[model samples]
Target chain A: MKKIINDPFNFVDESMEGILAAHSNLLKAAEGNVRAIVRADAPAAHKVAVATGGGSGHLPVFLGYVGRGMADGCAVGNVFSSPTSSQMKQVTKAVDSGRGVLYIYGRYQGDMMNFDMAAEDCAEDGIEVQTVLVTDDVASAPREEWQKRRGVAGLFFAYKIAGAKAETGSDLSSVRTAAEKAVSNMRSMGVALGSCTLPTVGRPTFSVSDDEMEIGMGIHGEAGVQRCKLENADQIAATLVDYVAEDLPFCKGDEVAVLVNSLGGTPLEELYILYREINRLLTERGIQIYRPYVGRYACSMEMPGASLTLMKLDDELKELLDAPAETPFFVQN
Target chain B: MKKIINDPFNFVDESMEGILAAHSNLLKAAEGNVRAIVRADAPAAHKVAVATGGGSGHLPVFLGYVGRGMADGCAVGNVFSSPTSSQMKQVTKAVDSGRGVLYIYGRYQGDMMNFDMAAEDCAEDGIEVQTVLVTDDVASAPREEWQKRRGVAGLFFAYKIAGAKAETGSDLSSVRTAAEKAVSNMRSMGVALGSCTLPTVGRPTFSVSDDEMEIGMGIHGEAGVQRCKLENADQIAATLVDYVAEDLPFCKGDEVAVLVNSLGGTPLEELYILYREINRLLTERGIQIYRPYVGRYACSMEMPGASLTLMKLDDELKELLDAPAETPFFVQN
Candidate 1:
């Protein structure tokens, strides 16, 4: 594997320096240790500021989403590693405007421990902070225990709702409610055809035969649920879409938004092929399409395979999603 | 180099069948043709129908971007190959609701021929279709005669502008004007760190050394301007950004939208590292950024490299961009 960096460890710092410098007009990091990227225009108001924090590899999702229509701020750690609690707290302090702040992020032990500690520290700073760890990856757990799964790409849908609520000057509770609604209504399943090579590790994170794939792999180098020889696009689609459709359990007339996300290495051609099959199954089942997204939403370096996310859209979400949003990563009508 | 297909020629057909079946609820292609994925509720006279067509494999760009705030229909051809004139005409005829349509797409010889022919066919069919090709790859030619260079990912910007205008009920001419403005103002340059294997050919469209990248390569596997040893992200950014900046003559205080697009195999982590450096160089020159997009907008089936697109934006362009639009690929404020 080849990569560009002064050193594996220096990669993040160098990136941080360059991103701040280039987007100085719009982006900046909060003072102190967290290295959270926040909008330069983040204002001081008595409004609840919503913040998210996670590892660094998933660009645009954890950080690039920080802008007018998304996250107010984000705390990032090393590749596939969780940020420190202090870092998370520092960003919360920087973006907090007195109405309190909400911490919404994926559910991971490192993230949960760090964010919970950060929330406690925020209270010590005289700022009320609440957190909701999104656990939308249905493949990670049984249906009745859905919340035990890791939060994957579906957090993006939550961000949209939370960001819009915050943008509307909603309070912390309201923002959190909207975000939680989005998260609760969302379900995701992922497959890995290839593994990622950590920049410093300089080897594959996991290995798969050229003719096999693993479903339910996390952003990290975790093993997936299923390991089977690669099948044609149709079968691949069936395997993935079945999981998604089953997890979401959408009825024939149920409306749901679809997100077909690539985990970095999968080709967009394949993504569309996958989506074509997914939609076919949904249609044959009489599902109503709300919104469909086909792209790389959250990725694990060059890891192949994809994740399918189905978000049960509500009126609030439909309006907010349809609302204009402009971020470094996503732009929507 | 593993692929899922029985026969080389059947790859495209099988993939399309799977796609149409999957997205049956929201997307459908013209019978017997893989190009032109249209909304099931076609013949939309209530809104201006937007049509775009180009080579395949640059996923989500031409087809996935064809929903909600994006194109009403898209004519996708073979990998790196343009759709036939009949395909374009069929798509136009399917999407045209007598509301007039705008044909916005990339500038490629094959696409130019087919889109033109399709427009003529649409004209004979009593449907109005205006065409505009986005030619922005600076490396394709020198700045003084930039028009000759073929189109690349810069077409995404044109699609947004035209899509937004059409969504706003703007006439075909006005939408075409917006798209043309975007094409004229935008400039892009791409480099491939490695080559991508075509599905049918089952081999790299071309080859590059493991230690080198092909700078300014066509998205369709065309040769690049240079094949130099790969350098750090900063140097790579300088090489691509310097050319794009110089070509566009982005001056101090000029507001430009920066897009760091992956060809296919590059990771978001890598793109961020690349963006960090690219932005740093631009900031030093005092260029203001409206927004920066870092993701896989147009890809070539896992080819590794990134493209830098600089679009000098004015108020008019900015507003059109912020208009509400939704597609399977990107949503913008």
Candidate 2:
């Protein structure tokens, strides 16, 4: 209940309003539809357009990535709820530049169904559409059935690489391939010390004892793999890294882009503390860190937790990720 | 006590270690002195150097500002404690390129005393040192005694302007004037819904009842001007903006830059929600928003609150603010 919002029901729309208002030069509402946002110069001619969408609350996920060298458009959903197929179709049609559209989003039941419907709807208009469902949360499924897993912070990697590929005037198939490559090589896991309340709910989504932490918790407070007593930063880093690295069996020589993402309430200082340990443990294991990103890339609504994501990178992905990107929430040079 | 840290006393040092490890290309310890960090390419031949330092918990405050177009060096401090005069002097000498050094930091007693001492020591070495104490927190003092007010997030503005001036090869006096101008035009105030626990203390710095909130609370949980029941976002924005704008008496048709900074724990979504309202109010008041920044530009560990800052802009300030700057924590293009 302790949140700075006007009407709980207007949370998503109002947040979108704030974003568009702040970054009008970089982003805009697609054809006056607040639910469908696209880059200001969205339908770039002959360039493969990358579109993404998901439930709200995770800023910089779907909408925050809508900009040059990132996703071309985003269908914004309600807080922790999927957007409608109509909204998704609007974004798809708005950003399609005759080069086709590529959909990159988290692997959630509601999202999968909605995005699929949007793709089918776009097909009738002759706008070729491809989907890459990011399933990189290792704890959500066994390694053999990784596609059934949930996507968490690993969505960032898929977007970065896929968006870069699309920006290079690549064909839709190539962009989709780059996205799929990122999803296949990524693994993420999180530990929640607290839960965030949905604005409409007016209560915490879940709870953890004052002396405990839950590992593998979903962004929506879904059941985590285990509940354990609170541990120090290094111990927490080791546990999360072990779960992530072992899932990919990220070998000794593998290079990775590490993202230590704050779920919502954790401070940047703690993320760095966690990152230092992750850097040490990975170096000890002979794995090189290609680039380390530490901040709130993905989040629950003021939830107290941090997730660690590792995306094994090849030369292609390295170039793609290093490409400049500018968005309302993310900027790189 | 819910934090990710090991050996609370080692919190500052470890966090600094993490920063160095992550950004070795842009920052490095001065002469193996971890407490004194300078830009990787410090003493940029004949350019004026900017040296800033304060307590450690506020990431991206002093240390985070050291970079190519920001502060050239910083002396690290323990959580909520000032760095020693000796450490400050080391940084001053490390970054000085025979052009001189400008000292910019908050108007805190400990910081003032330490920085003054450092300047005195550096003066013995014939290194000209100028100081500008940021006193932008309008809630901290009456306008008649603005010099006694505490500096909060306004430090970012001073750094941006002063750093840009120095990058232009301006002499020390001109660089100091730019910082002073920014400090004079800026006003900031904050509201706290919850408190952050210092690692060594292992408890909330201050407590607010679950149903109550404090307005104008300091970054270190210092007393504010008011405490009342929780209010909605628009009302909160109205109060904060009124204080900031009226204090400067920001006139009609005046263009200004707005910074909506999270203390730490507040989510970016909430910050944007607040920004949307502030933008509406400013527009209604005939005030123009030049460049709006909504994020954790300054933070207090994991405190749940936010501060609003308004800096009236002129052509000169606008040009300097728009100039490019890159650091470990901030990047402007």
Candidate 3:
């Protein structure tokens, strides 16, 4: 992969600097630590601020969600790695009001350890912290072991719903509950047509023959449940939707929001093409789509493939999803 | 180029069908002709309607701009090809109210021919028509012959500024002038890291060595003015910015809107990396960046590259840009 970057050592920091500079009015570094960033108007009085963090390389993830009606602060780590507990602590303190804070991030061992340490540290400072780890990738675990599933694009829903709930002046527990509900109601699965290279490593993360695709592949190139000859867009969509829909066992009357996300290098045109098939299959199955989002919500560098995420929506979830949000990467009004 | 598409021949129409299905509330096909699309509430009484069209590959370009505070309708063609004159006529007629209509599109021989034919046909129907051709690619022609240059991402500014002007109930002439001003003030240049394949062709549009990058390439893989070994983000940004800035002779203290657009396959992370350096260079030159837009704006299929656009802004342009606009692919509030 040909990446347009500077020194590999400076990749993450430079990218963060670029974001801070471009959106100075909307975001700011926490006490000059670029790794710990918060919304410009952080610690909004009487509001339960939401905090999130994860590795870099995923634009619009980790840091891009820090803004109005989304995460208030984010602890950014190196590419595909966890942020330091100190950085998480800085973000927690920077965004926390008297109402407390919530940490909602993808489920990863490194993130779990770091965020847990940060939470424990913050508790000693008289600040309450709650966490709702996102584990919506169905391919990561069987139904009986869903808790072991890793998070993927479903993190977008957790942020939007929980952020909107927090913006309503809800208590930390209420916001955490909303996040948990979103996390439980969503399912995601992805396929990889090609691999991405880490800037410093200077290599393909994994190898896949040009004529084949790995279905249900993890964003980090983890082994997938299936690898087969490449299929057309319609066949791909049908296979993905079936896996996700069946996992959720979404009934005929269920109304849901659909997200056809580009992992990285896939163009918007292809996403829409896939969406057409997905929409048709859903309609055929008598499932109504309340709203559809087709674009790059989360990515894995320049990996050439896509992911499909479906979130079952009830009245409250629908209202929260409809609420206004303005993150650096996502905006819904 | 492994594209996720079925029936390469059905690519354009299927994609259009997908867009309509995903955004039914925001858009609709004109008179059941999917090739001619219009805003769901097009033909606003007493409002001068703006229409645009181009090939299919560039999302948010020809069709995505059709919505509130933007173009009223669009005529979509095959990949990197022009919409037929009849398709343009369908769009023109569908969007025209008692008020006149204006055609704002890129400057291409085929597009010009088709749009001219459509204009003549619309004129016979008693609807006044005006046009503003976008010619912002500085690499295509010298300053003295700028009118001969091809259009690229500058089409974005034209739709935004002119579309907002029309939304204010401005006459066709007034809207045309706004678009013309935008076309004249902006300059853009691009660098391609790799080629894209037309679904039907099943081959790369052009070739670039793995270690090379082509500078000043057109959206359709037209021959670039220069090709060199791939450089780091900073050097690439400097090269593109210098070419765009010197062409406009954009002076110190000039307030401008900066667009660092992904041609297609470049990842968002790399775009920000490029934006950081571009922003710094502009600041060092005493040029004020009024607003910055990064990410995929106008694209060239799944081509791996990016383009930088700088539009010198005046008070009128600034106010127009700030006007609220909502489209399937773009939104400003």
Q: Judged by DockQ, which candidate is best?
A: 2
> Local error of candidate 1 at A122, Å?
1.9
Per-model TM-score versus the true fold: 0.84, 0.99, 0.99
Off by over 4 Å in 3: none
Model 2 Cα lDDT, one tens digit per residue, B1-333: 788888898888888888888889899998888889999998878899999999988876878889978899999889988999999999999999999999999999999999999999999999999999999998889988898999999999988999999999999999999999999899998999988998988888778998888999988889999999989999999999899999988889999999999888888788889999999999999999999999888899888889999999999999999999989888887
Displacement of the residue B266 alpha carbon in candidate 2, Å: 0.9
Q: What is the lDDT of residue B135 in candidate 2?
A: 96
Tens digit per residue, CA lDDT, model 3, A1-333: 477889988998888888888889899999899999999998877899899999998887878888888889999999999999999999999998889999999999999999999999999999999999999898999987888899899988899999999989999889999999888889998999999899999989888897899999988888889999999999999999999999987779999989999998888888999999999999999999999999888889888899999999999999999999887787777
Listing every candidate in turn, what is its Cα RMSD in Å to the true structure after a full C-alpha superposition?
4.2, 1.0, 0.9
Residues A1-333, candidate 2, lDDT per residue (tens digit)?
Answer: 778889989888888889889999988888799899988997877899999998899986778888888899999999988998999999999999999999998889999999999999999999999999989888788899999999899888888999899888889888899999999999999999988999999988777999999999998888999999999999999999999999988889999999999998888788888999999999999999999998889999688889999999999999999999888888888
Q: Which rank order by DockQ, best down to worst? A: 2, 3, 1
Displacement of residue B32 (Cα, Å) in model 3 is 0.7
Note the Cα lDDT for every prediction shown. 0.78, 0.90, 0.91
Tens digits of per-residue lDDT for model 1 on B96-189? Answer: 8788888887778888888898898889889987778778988787788877788888878887778777777777788888888888888999
DockQ of each: 0.39, 0.77, 0.74
Q: Which has the higher TM-score value, candidate number 1 or candidate number 2?
A: 2
- TM-score of model number 2: 0.99
Kindly list the per-residue Cα lDDT of model 1 for residues A16-111, writing each as its tens digit: 675675566666788834377777776446567878888877765687677777777889899888988888877888888888888888998999
